[model samples]
Target: MKVPLEIRPGSDAGLGYVKYGNGPVHVLVMHDWLGDHASYDAVVPWLDGHALTYVFVDLRGYGQSIALTGEFTVEEIAADCLTLADQLGWGRFHVIGHSMTGMITQHIAADAPSRVTSAIAVCPVSAAGNRLSPEALTFFASTVDDDNALRRLFKFVSGGLSDEWADSKVQHSRATVAPACRRPYLDMLVTANFVDDVQGLATPFLVMVGDNDPGLDAKAMQRTFLAWHPNAELHVIPDCGHYPMQACPRYFATVVERFLKRHTT
Candidate 1:
């Protein structure tokens, strides 16, 4: 089902969100850094018949929230998700965070343990943060101005998807984001750390990684999430890269559905 986008007051900005399904189980899906709620479009059909309610949200300066502005830090983003949940009158719910939002999910689970039922981090960045080298940071900063470079960067993330897909992703991102939000967020995601913040977090976690995803693999999850959370479990999706949901939507949805059924029931 389609719902009109509603803007809710976030910490220092406004967040836009849309809800789907009518199941009693409530889930909040956070978008990746590259795209907004639309990033999960491929998985929608798979969830269309499920007995769950899924809410897809856009961070400030992205998608429907493109006009909104904020600090864009992980902490602020996590707060926005909680605020949305409150607005929805959901006392507790599950969170499915992809890519950068994966990191944001940790903040949500860490900050409000009692409010979160479970967390699914799909191709997520660990809560401890991903420290990048000065050279790599410089290169990422450059992509803000260079579309071709940005497209090429996604190639690595997608493990070499078709040109059409890459172009569409680049176009959508450029149209929806401003450099002010993009640059600072990139800086934050690459350098921020929260090892102590998430220590001893008991929230049930389902960490999904793509076998072809270069940086965030099963091994990485083992070291970061598995080592940190005693209740966390990792699953590897084969023959796909960072965007497994997009690469194989049905399979991705099936895996997530199974996990939620097991834990959220």
Candidate 2:
């Protein structure tokens, strides 16, 4: 059955959302900056089987959500997130943020510790030593530039994935993206605090990343997080990249299910 989802105005942050699920635990699933609800299509089925409710949010300027002009800080997004949850009657819930949205999750965990039960930051963006981290920047610049290069890069990075698969995925991403929605998400990163933000956060956490992911120094970030907050655990999915939920749904679901079960209230 399709769950009823509605758009709720954020007053300041443009478009906000509210959706309901059936399980005792409610999860707010935040997508990568470029993604929409469709991004979860691969992982949702597995998540649905776990018998918990899920709320997938389209961040400001992405998908059906509206972008707040000028003042687009992560705090604004985070505030809208909590407000939307309140509007949905979710007194306490869990959050799972993927890719860039991981930054938003950290802001929430840091600011509203009492409302969130647990958080999973999946292949999240981290302190890159420098924003111009040459290798990582090259990966992103290619995606935003050369089409053929994007395909080759995808194949090279995702590893174990065939040429046909890589080509199709790249095509799908390029074809589906909203040309107008493409822009900066600096407010999000800024509001969340980069790299060392929310050290030793009290919120129980899980950090999952693909073995071949190049978004950040995955191993180093994981170690830094654990050193600061002893409550967090890390899971590395083999043969995957930044988009583990889509590239390795089965593995992603299993990891999430186990974590949710152990932490579910």
Candidate 3:
């Protein structure tokens, strides 16, 4: 049975989080660019609360942290997560990041190697950055202000399915995300290259890719995350798109929990 997660207010400098379970292993979860903590609602129940404590956080410009002001850069977001952990009195914790936060997860692990025991990224953006055609770049850039465009982009990314789901995602993101932070974050995910920073990092990483996530295909992942990090493993979840936590919650949670169990100290 799944226990309810507790909503905890964050500090002045950190983003708010939903705390789940009371296990020895601490895990910080970062949502994707288009979704907030609510994105993990389905997956939460399937997680092993007895073995892992999950902290699902909203990025500085999204969810409960929308009011907080910041540059919304990957480094800044990583710092915010670290600050939240410190405020919670956690010495060391595992990190899980979805979509854009996945790339941010890499930064967090590299920035504080000793503090993060292991990291997991789900349908993550590559740490090396994305390569988009000029037209594609323009299209994505324009979605910053247009919710309909954003919804269309979501559908395009999710393999042309789940229109209603994508619509809800766009609405949630538009309402919760700070308008100023959207484009900057998209720029970071597409242009910020951290190859040198994460090249030889020893922190273990589990990269979970939804088989249907057109953006992060097997070859793309191999060329980036798998190639850049020394200690990393990849798992492909079948019949899932860019948002596996929403499309296949039970499987997603199980895969993540199993990886954590293997890596837990």
TM-scores, one per candidate: 0.94, 0.80, 0.94
Clashing pairs in 3: none
Answer with 2 or 3, whichever has the higher lDDT: 3
lDDT of 1 at 213: 94
lDDT of 2 at 11: 47
Write the residue-wise lDDT of candidate 1 on 2-118 in tens digits.
533333433343477767777788999988777878888888888844478888888888877887788889888888888888878898899999888888888999888998999
Each prediction's RMSD over C-alphas, in Å, is 2.3, 3.7, 1.6
Task: Mark the 10 consecutive residues where model 3 has the least summed lDDT.
Answer: 2-11
- lDDT over C-alpha atoms for residue 183 of model 3: 86
Error of 2 at 58 (Å): 0.5
TM-score of 2: 0.80
Candidate 2 lDDT over residue span 232-251, tens digit each: 88887777777777788877
lDDT of 3 at 33: 73
* TM-score of structure candidate 1: 0.94
Name the runs in model 3 displaced over 4 angstroms: 1-4
